[model samples]
Target: MSAMVDTPAAQPLPRRTEGSSARIGALAPLSSPGWVEAGRHLLAGLESGVLDVNDAGGVLGRPLELVVRDTAADPQRAAAAVEELAGLGVAAVAGEYHSVVARAAAAKADALGLPFLCSSAVLDALTDRPTDWVARLAPAQSHGWRIYAEFLLGAGHRRIAVAAQPSVYWESGTRILREHLAPRCGTVIELDMGALTPEDVCDALADHGATALLLLTGIPEPAVSLVRSVRADRRLAGVLVGAPAGQPEFGPWAALLGEDGAGIPFLRYLPERLGPLGARVGSALRERLGRAPSFVAFEGYDTITVLADVLSAGELSRERIPASWAGVAVEGTRGPIRFSRVPGVGVRQWAWAPVQVVDRDPAALDRFRVLRTG
Candidate 1:
């Protein structure tokens, strides 16, 4: 896909028929370079959301339809998808797990005056300036990472090392961890994964006397290697390994690493317990996904739930949807869904979705144990 072109004027809503569907543009990273497992779970939730909505009579008695696009984790592809979706007269846009890609999509959607409810992107600034055109369901990186930092402190890790790849998203996360930990007498050691090997990272942890090493690198390559190297190092045997970016939330991380993957903490947006609505949604999502649903999947379901509420509130015009964000109050699978302006975030945020520090249990690699919550 190409880069986003000049902003187009807001297109009129498509003509409705009694049998015609209400279209929503769905974006996901379904190919390489993107987290394909995360995308599959996200799409399952999105598709499941549409199914539930249609079963409930959909928006204004029209079936809710998803115009799915594979972003492949490219910002250019995502931006272009937004333009195409806007031109297609989609009532709104939703779903993107990658923060950078979501930023591109959000910017394009904002420019095109297309209302977008972001599903799982947690970057603090989804847009450069505040815009009613975009809103997000996931807690901001600052919010969630701060919680993870707290978890680290409570776990007695005052010195931490981050093996990070270069990216705006990773940089922001590192910054969040550093800033949050600094005032509390904690130190953050930066290991540039671009210049260092996984063995080098393990050596750094031993030399720096850091008690925790967070994986801020991409999955299956540096991240997987770093985990293996650190776990194998006798000098760093007691060191805590974490991935605050939620890499361990999906199946592939466990599938590849097996017992080696267990006990590595990560951030997840979910409550301690699910309500009746959540239980039903979880069961349906499990059936659709052929496995347990990650928090990203629930984020997808909630994205459509919020959008459906906005569309059903009154008029289904594109212009009307942005305004409806403030008025939104619906029961999402996670919890009560509402949007409000959060400090440092440009888009209307869910205030917070439930945040947890979780890791797969060593005794049972398939099960997750909640280590902390915020």
Candidate 2:
């Protein structure tokens, strides 16, 4: 006898409790290899400050609770995570480190009409997409590329060799650098990161007589390898090696390279020169994690703090958050945090995010001196 097939009923979406707590969703790569600690630091920042709303008198008289979800740095998983967050009835969503995952989650959040404030995803296109519900705390790669190009040119490096990994973030940054440097520099050689080994890259620099080498990659392994190779080769001694501000694994980079990482500069959002607020945040982070906070950690802390301020001033709802955010100007760990619609990047995005150049010298490695700000 043929049996009738059983159909499972769809699960109901989570309803807002309408009580003393307001829930927010955080989507990040908590299980991934490189970004797991970043996720933890983000959570720690929230719980220690904004999420402890009850002690701080709460936002709109409601304490904040963060609902954490791991995206595993996967695009599909990121999209699903957004849906799950919406189903759980969060006031809004935030936190993502990977550019691909952030892009996916941004689209999902926009379609679902949820507010998403991206923390550390620096891919230029993350804010370039046509989405009104999404905003970024980190400056786009285009802005960062401009800063890097200017820094190189100002340092009298005319012959520049670019080595970039094959990824969305690196590719976009490489393109921007080429555009900005072509007219200004005497010679700019573009090298595909995957096609060449560390030795091959150094050899190309030696062959071209490049004065400076710009290594653009998100992963620490390739950057560490390239820096090591360059230092070992005596011929390429004077070439100034630099990296962009996307690598969150800087602690590992410092540990692996030791003194070799010295004189190698990279862009960063959080300069060591902190104001009163920045100093307080840094101390709190050190206490919680047993070390100073990374740029990603600061981004997470600021994102929640911004959201809390917005929620406190106006009605607590996803629809109202964007409008509220656009009007307020708050002091972040970096500096004044504000949002505006740039010509290229999307609306309500924080375009004027500050950046600095930090070197990895053994004696002064921790000193994140400000090279340039834009």
Candidate achieving the largest TM-score:
1
In lDDT terms, which candidate is top?
Answer: 1
For model 1, what is the error of residue 118's alpha carbon versus the real structure, in angstroms, after optimal superposition? 0.5
lDDT score at residue 166, model 2, on the 0-100 scale: 74
- Looking at model 1, report the run of 10 residues with the lowest lDDT sum: 1-10
For candidate 1, list the clashing residue pairs, or say none. none
**Native-structure RMSD, model 2:** 7.1
Reference-based TM-score of each model: 0.97, 0.89
lDDT by residue for model 2 over 143-184, one digit each (tens)? 877887888888888888888777777777777877888898
Residue 294, model 2, lDDT: 77
Q: For candidate 1, write residues 1-374 as lDDT tens digits.
A: 11223434566887877678889999999999999998998898899899999999888888899999999999999999999998898999999999999999999998988988889999998888778888899999999999999999999999999999999999999998889999999999999999999888888889999999999988999898998998899999899999999999888899999999999999999999999988999999888888889998898998889989998874678877777888999999999999888777888889889999999999998899999999
Q: What C-alpha lDDT does candidate 1 achieve relative to the native structure?
A: 0.90
RMSD of each: 3.4, 7.1
Clashes of 1: 0
